[model samples]
Target: MSYSVHVLHNGYSYLKDGVMRANCTCTLIKGPNLVIVDTMTAWDKDVLLEGLAKENTSCADVKYAVGTHGHSDHLGNLNLFTAATHIVGYSVSYKDEFFIHPFETGEPYKIDDSLQVIPTPGHTTEDVSVVVKTAHQGTVVVAGDLFEREEDISDPSLWRYIAGSENPDKQQKYRNEVILLADHIVPGHGPMFKVTEDMKDVARRDQLTQK
Candidate 1:
């Protein structure tokens, strides 16, 4: 089964009143089932919902709401999708009938034939990236902080902002694995881009450097 992936936001960080505010990229997968990858920040709830409305989709239509990690920016608005199944790496409580599911690393949770949630822990111990088999793009990976942007693959320093990422070696390994697994990547905080051979080579070089 093939699906269509839509990027609701190309995340970025900027200063507002001398305070840093960031938004994580949010993506929606439309196929046999509707799936929302990330929910950006709490402040973006309105925009996110509006974007879905513009697409003729609503939170109630979402079958699954999967957060790439536990970061506030990525899972802040999860409660808004009360009609969808919430999947996360860590445990959380919700007052509604909505079920909160927990996923582990190395296991791919199949939402449908076209969508799979694969653990890509690096930014956080529970980070998971969603792999969607798209009709036009082949395999598209909604990588959370695994690859924040295209340059993050080659820049080790970019990992510095990853909260609780203590194992740099393991993190680099996961990064390489995600890049190899994705044909196109919707990074956690940047526009979607193709994962070409050149990008793979760069990731390889970065891996070697880390070793």
Candidate 2:
């Protein structure tokens, strides 16, 4: 069976022969098993399963179906992977309780003992980011909504919304968690950032300055 991956760019998807653009960033990582990061809007179970089957991996082997948060965009197609175990941080596990879904803790479930999950809420109550250490990719962070590359990354309104939301104190905690990451930053909706030592220094400096 052929193993491959597909990184569906959130924006600029319409440039391909004038097709419609979808929601959140969708990533299908297929190896011995299958793992989907986020399921964008307008995408359903059949479409995702069909696309994944192209790589010779069926939805049945989807050992892990996870979301960075409870947002509609991220968890839109979660029902498609019902057979697979769901992974989400403890803070937002209640959201899936109604569905009678059994979800494991993101931090404890490691992929090859190299990838880790850092719970960084504030964008929402259950937002989390995935950190990976691959032989080829080195250290990388899959920051879902918690961080972005667009100008909105530091927009005052967004920050205010996060800081003044239902969990205001958690905002600082989330920022602190991000500051601890000295690895490459990959956002859910923008270009990835090479996390160099210099960039980490800048990010830490900015965090301290904000404090």
Candidate 3:
């Protein structure tokens, strides 16, 4: 089955008082399974519920709730998705029941033929990114903090200085990999952006070799 990716909410991030005040981008994928990626902050719960209602989906219908990382901004509203199989970073759970998955070792969790969750890390070392293949969008990568925004593709410093990635080198490497694999990307704290050859070139950490 083919899937459709929807940007339920585009998040924002800004630096203030040596702190990053941020909200994570929340996405929805509908196909074989109803998936919600990054629930956003708790304060935005009502807004998230409303967004789901508008799509004719309820929290109860969601089969999977994926938090790109353990950050509060990303998983704050997870309590709303109790029935969903929860994927928070490298851990998977449902209520008190837990299931093991080797995300840390690069094993991707497949939700369906059209959707999969791949380990991305870098932001906090256990981060994940959702990849959706749709008829219209081709392939869309729901990249969490691995990319702060579209500008991060062109300016490395924009993300390096603000995202505080735990492993800058790995983040950069995977960011390049995602850019190469995706037709579009939904970044952590910004609007979606189209992938282009120029963007791929800019994202690559090593320019000596060509792909």
Candidate 4:
């Protein structure tokens, strides 16, 4: 079956007089087994439900609820999908039962020919991203904080410094990896963007910044 990526909720992060506020992007993978990536914050419950309804999907329609990482803003609504498999960070589980999965530190977990989940750390060691093969877009990577926002390509500080990167050095490496592979990236806290040379340059520039 074919798969496509859809953003249910666009994420954002901004500073308000020294205080930072943010929410993670929520994305849906439409295919044989529907997958929802990054549930956003818990407070956005009503909005999330409405977003799913708008897509003609219900909570039960989603087979997988994936949290790119264990951040509160990303996995807050996990409880709503008890029937679906929850892939948070490197671990997979169904309610109270945890399951072992090889997505841990190597190789992308293949869901089907059209979709897979890659192990993309650096935002946090356990971070992961959903990669979907779409006909129009080619390859769409629902990267978590790995890309941040499209603006982060020009101003790395927005994601590395202000947003708090656990490992800027490691983050830069994965940033380059994803940029090279994806035609479009759905970032953790911003709108999706088409890959451009500038984005590639920024990813490469990070190596120089460290020197």
Q: Per-residue lDDT tens digits of candidate 1, residues 88-182?
A: 75443344444445455376777777788887776777788888988799799998877767766666566555323655666778878777778
lDDT of 1 at 47: 87
Best by lDDT: 3
What is the overall TM-score of model 1 with all chains considered together?
A: 0.85
lDDT of each: 0.78, 0.57, 0.89, 0.87
Top of the candidates by TM-score: 3
C-alpha lDDT (0 to 100) for residue 56 of candidate 3: 91
Query: What is residue 136's positional error in candidate 2, in angstroms?
Result: 1.3
Candidate 4: residue 42 Cα off by (Å): 1.0
Worst 10 residues of 1 by lDDT: 91-100
Off by over 4 Å in 1: 14-19, 90-105, 161-164, 204-211
Instruction: Give the Å error, residue 125, model 3.
Output: 1.0
lDDT of 4: 0.87
TM-score quality measure for candidate 3: 0.94
C-alpha displacement of 23 in model 1, angstroms?
1.0
Candidate 4 Cα misplacement greater than 4 A, ranges: 201-211
Off by over 4 Å in 2: 1-6, 11-22, 31-33, 42-56, 89-112, 153-176, 179-182, 196-198
Q: What's the distance in Å from true for residue 66, model 2?
A: 0.9
